[model samples]
Target: METREHSATAGPDVAPPVLTRIPARMDRLPWSRFHWLVVVALGITWIFDGLEVTLKGAISGVLQEPGTLHFTSAEIGSITSFYLAGAVSGSLIFGYLTDRLGRSLFFFVTLAVYLCGAFLTAFSWNLWSFILFRFITGMGIGGEYAAINSAIDELVPARLRGRIDLIVNGSYWIGAAIGAASTVILLDPAIFPVDVGWRVGFGVGAVLSLFILFLRRHVPESPRWLVIHGRSDEAERIVSGIEGQIEKETGATLEEPEETLAIHPRKSFGFGVIIRGMFTLYPKRSLLGLSLMVSQAFLYNAIFFTYALILTRFYHVPAGKTGLYLLPFALGNFCGPLVLGRFFDTIGRRQMIAGTYTVSALLLALTGYLFTVDLLTPFSQTALWTVIFFFASAAASSAYLTVSEIFPMETRALAIAFFYSLGTGAGGVVAPWLFGTLIGTGSRMAVFYGYLAAVVLMLAAAVIEIRIGVKAERISLEKVAEPLSAKK
Candidate 1:
């Protein structure tokens, strides 16, 4: 029987809708090869992002040395800031396209865009060209965060969503770990010229994107998206194909989907509608998402972007040796989500998110105080960061998970983009510069002040989350938040 109806907004060009069990069909499936395909194809986006941003920091000192880019600490900070600005712009722009144009299109486009940016970065002749390339690369990654996060959340099984999302997001540090290890060799003056090693580092990310692009081809668009856009027939067909593939792979009888949602097919959403839905219809979710985004963005950008500078400026670590410190830090961040992700599913989102955020804050406060008093060596400092981010990374990753799952199906991509851009723009774009200035001042006390600010913001966010967080675990997307086009 036909399950969908036309909204007044769906135009004559829209096809007649049919009933689809796509959402239920998707959410009820067991883990299969198909899920692995999606994870590898879409999730590597974080790896590229981890690689890109980590390379920026990992090579900061290399760029400052003679016969390289000859950049100053401030210039490196500015370059990183430009990348964040590009990311902000990209998220807003591509985010809208993902919602309007469908997830399948933007996944390919964004990956290609990133490849172009990362490849060109290797050819940069000076700081200006380097910044321009970095900005372009950032735009690609920013777009990926919106489109890919929306797709992943929409498509993954409800029971597995929290852990999978956290793991995928945390996988950024896997890239960071790879970047750190590679830079240790790439930045070695004995093996390659100082100038050539850094350029090769940028090329590695572009090369990695080629593999992901191939894997993404077999992945399908969100059936949830197709049905709401008056394409329920297509949605049903895709889900059927998915079920067939999963059954063949697992050789187990698939359970029938019990839930079905009816949506009034929408042609498109206007800017005014999107804005209203985000701010008016879902006000608390909006605020919670913003707080999470901003706090994590502030702490991550302020510290990670300038970490090498801290090592070189304060502890006298060599430019090449900086990666050795970063490798352990990246592992700590990576392991956090892998270890703690399941708890977000089992223990509940509110308790886990709030607890992680609060604990990370306390750890940071202790770490900052120790640093201010000159009680930390380079080794101890990295150790503290490893422990601190063991919690902070999961909290930061949950920030992404929260924003993606809390809104209506129609607004998922744009909402992700909006929060990411706002939070990242407000916090991320300014953090590197702020920390750069503090590092420039050569004062441990000055940098500690920045740490204090991050702690306060994190605590405030934890309070907000505890009070108003969405307990979205093991719930279908439509149940968590109804489709905007649902019949009342």
Candidate 2:
């Protein structure tokens, strides 16, 4: 039997810690192993995601090559938009499929399809074909967010979920770092033609996909998913097998854990069931989606679209050096979640959300000021960018985890994809256009970013008002999902 720890911090009148019974053991080494797989998978996914981030518009020089396929700047921008469309569709379609068809299958298929798209995109004969293939690849990237996050929610123990989720999300920045590094390593202009740089970058994603697919073979389907689908027999077997490992490790005498399972557990799924369940089970998640979509679309696109200008005009940074120039910035982003995530469960979700947002906003504003004042040295510029990037990355990490945990299992995948799409599609897609248009006059870019920072701070303010906020309980999918839909 597992022993419980009492919280002396709780008032004498407060209730004791209540444990949510799960199908398998949460204490064994396997739990950590399970999370490792997710972390690795996320890292791999981000590598490809990172490649997209790097290769998207970087091909301007390559496209200028006489023998290479030609693309107008407008056509190139359309391709990026096309990629975002794929992401939006992937989030909704693959998200629903993950829940209905089972996580393992969707995971495999999505990875495969994404890989093929990347391969096709790399070898495209024309800009149109490249756009088509890029869209296909992006769908996989979009699907990955929902599929990976849902799997994490269902499989990880609640208490560790927040921290783990933060870690997983952080991998995307690691992808960015890798992307930047790869520019220097794989695409050195002296040794390799610029034409080969984009192709090499695309190839990296395809290779990474293969490795991730191979690693996923040993990963198990969520026990919670099985029980929900009414696969008691299979769920029991998985649970028992996990417990058997726990017995060998902890040597704690086991008692039958109390658990209630769904009846007529769904065996098969269809588009209709996924679509209906999405809204029915996740009414409130749309709010989160709106927030995330707005936040991501705004910040990411703004930074990406304007990076060259920011580095050159703001920091006196050279254009060619951009490849390795973002290291500090990426590092800050990479570290934010691991450092901040530890406190999310205990610190109160709203406070963390607000705090991180305020910090990020302030940092961005600081970067803008340095830019406007013409006071930027390369060293000082990089330092300021690093700190700001960290805050932004951490805040965004928390959002993804919160969204994943705050919906019912019935619509978990859809909720993840839906809101993510909104954030990335709406906020991300328009951010560049808005930033470019608004970034007129002196310090316009700074002021524009300042406005975005303010909006995030506003979101932080409103988070506390919502009753369904992040809680300290071991963040089980159950607590996050809410009983609103299941009660029906």
Candidate 3:
């Protein structure tokens, strides 16, 4: 297969159209060590996010101890909100920059920012300092979401995109489990001093990030992004390198791709173009993305962030043992995506997305009813939550999958950032704070009502998904959403 580039100088303002085989070349390649490298390097973003969130949740009780920060429940909730606020800001800022700069550049920059924030968090002297550092950490993870997802979707083969995306997103719980398990030792009174243990927990995230930075150095920029941005020479060189690597690993001749894409290469897309394309051109897709993101964000943020408090406040479970309970919850969440991810590709996106969302909602309603009736112990409560989130985790993972693939390549990262920022800003930023205040009231019914609201939003998302979700299974990204620069 050969790339054919033709410069169509229709006008001074218009970009020259270049017909290239980059997309088909990427989509048809067999899975190999190169793909695995991409997964490990890029997918670790979600793991770090999971670690940051679970670390805070695990240490919330420790922060409230008189010997430590002695923060109230409301203050703990506010700290979570501050982190999410920073995420919203970071996604918007870096998401656009990732599009303008390059995927390879921002992933490293974001990880470095996270390392700085997390390391600084270990030495926070007061409530404000802790919140400030946490906010900075959230910004890094938020930026990761936009840059990493776009890069993953572009590089991975079309046949495996759905499952790979789901599994990568699901890996967040691996970090969650790590955070929970580490706290069991870190927060223990016998193992470390009351204040010292919580500090080490923050340091763990920083240390892990420092390691990932070295690994990501080997990953390359997106060829698709390059070709469209008038860097076809670089794009061709990178794709040729990847193809050679994959062929060498398998020791087999690679088949040539049959299809090609024609793109009018440009320097960058304006924010206004992305906004108009998402809302004006793809309205239903925009709504579907928003609903899925908002519902899952609210459900996960509300329940997960405040779960330790629910145990301590209602069931009187000791704060030190909360990590033990979270272990099972994290296992259930991690397993959900691993088990159900393949079905997404086989069963199709529309059906699987709708089914998972609807099922999780119904399960949540039942669990909330059980809690309100006061017939369950801590063990039973955790058990039921584990079951509910089994499906909920998959549902949440699919939300990221939906937004990333359904838009034009030029707009992909910004679109993810826009929806993530909007959805997270609207739902995630307030859920923890709201649920924490509700849990503070010592009323099971109040907390149950919060769960009920999440159910409503989730069920609504299911209906919208059933109505208009894209059937993108096994389809090339270029085919799913034609590039904004594509020429007739």
Candidate 4:
């Protein structure tokens, strides 16, 4: 059977449908069925990924009604923090589990947990209830990085990995865009009540999980994992299936028939293995991981969570128009990789890492000045906001690309969770709180203080990378090698 996109939506939920048609090969790499399966799975996970954030972004709209979950700002922050904490825990735990167990079963586990959270979030009557639900959702989201990335990393050839990874990760923003836009599209006080709109938004996200579950049946575990785990029988079976699919759709012939080769199995899976596995991979990678996490957390939270709030709270823009204004920010996110990802391989991951973070930091700093001094009008502020976010998204995607690739196969998932929790989840949890609290304090100056600090920190990392590049950025994935080839 030919595989299609996991879900064809604006973000990861919606994939660019997979066809039975065989993709032409560049070099020896033929487009294979297994590869497509990995792509769709990641994309679907990402679609729900956006829904998680969009639901939170539209909280103000939901709470407008008198009886719906009346909660204080601090309380709201605490609840949101739980979601982030859950994601963090999920990522760390799942990363090791994927390495120890396999990607196959864990995918279902994550999705199932996420679905439970999504429904509970939609049905929750109070703020705390929503938080509890959202925490479950976060755990799924946390597992998302380790599980999806591990599956794709193992299956997709290194050459195409950079571009594919960027595309895969970039879909999250598209998810965010569609999710945020849905809030505006479904805005009807008469037909769709405010709280109901938010509920529907989450329900839409959760409903997507079901269709993806259907697609999951078509997905097999990574053949590489099979080979690593001493499951050559299953690996060969999967390889044969993929080859058969390729031959059917693309009319391509394999260079050789699938043959049994001695599979080199890793040591037994255990908690000690993950702990030792990470350090054995190179101690510096962990430091790079930490920096990436800190930079990514601040940059993402600053933009996605805060941008819509800026339009509504500061500029007095209507809720509907806020989505439109934020559209540029989302579009900026989608375009960043298309423009900069080409450099990940050529300039080498290190240089692109430095350049992206450096430029993003600079752009953000300028955004602060523009806002701080009141240089930009309401219109320009929004436009400038989008411009900065464009670079921020690029920086974030690039950061993850490097972070995901550097660790040893044994610790890859665990390392990703370790860094990602501090970086992405921390950002998601805090961005709203920091901005909301500081802004509410009647100090517009707080935006400058907060963002300026982020800029400086991000730039510092770029500078360090310039001096001595991290190994992950230097090791290019073989699959997307051509796409990231040096620009002339």
Clashes of each: 1, 14, 0, 20
Tell me the tens digit of each residue's lDDT in model 3 across 421-450. 987876776787689789989999999999
lDDT of 1 by residue, 36-140 (tens): 989999999999888887777778877898898799978986897889888988899999989988999999999998999999999998999999998999899
What pairs collide in candidate 1?
3-19
Off by over 4 Å in 3: 1-9, 65-74
Ranking by TM-score: 3, 1, 2, 4
Q: Which candidate's lDDT is highest?
A: 3
TM-scores, all models, native as reference: 0.94, 0.86, 0.95, 0.85
Local distance difference test values of all predictions, in order: 0.88, 0.67, 0.89, 0.68
lDDT by residue for model 4 over 350-401, one digit each (tens)? 7777877888888888878878786776689867766776666667776677
For model 2, give the 10-residue run with minimal summed lDDT.
11-20
Candidate 3 lDDT at 334 equals 87
Pairs that collide, model 3: none
> Candidate 1 vs candidate 3: which has greater TM-score?
3
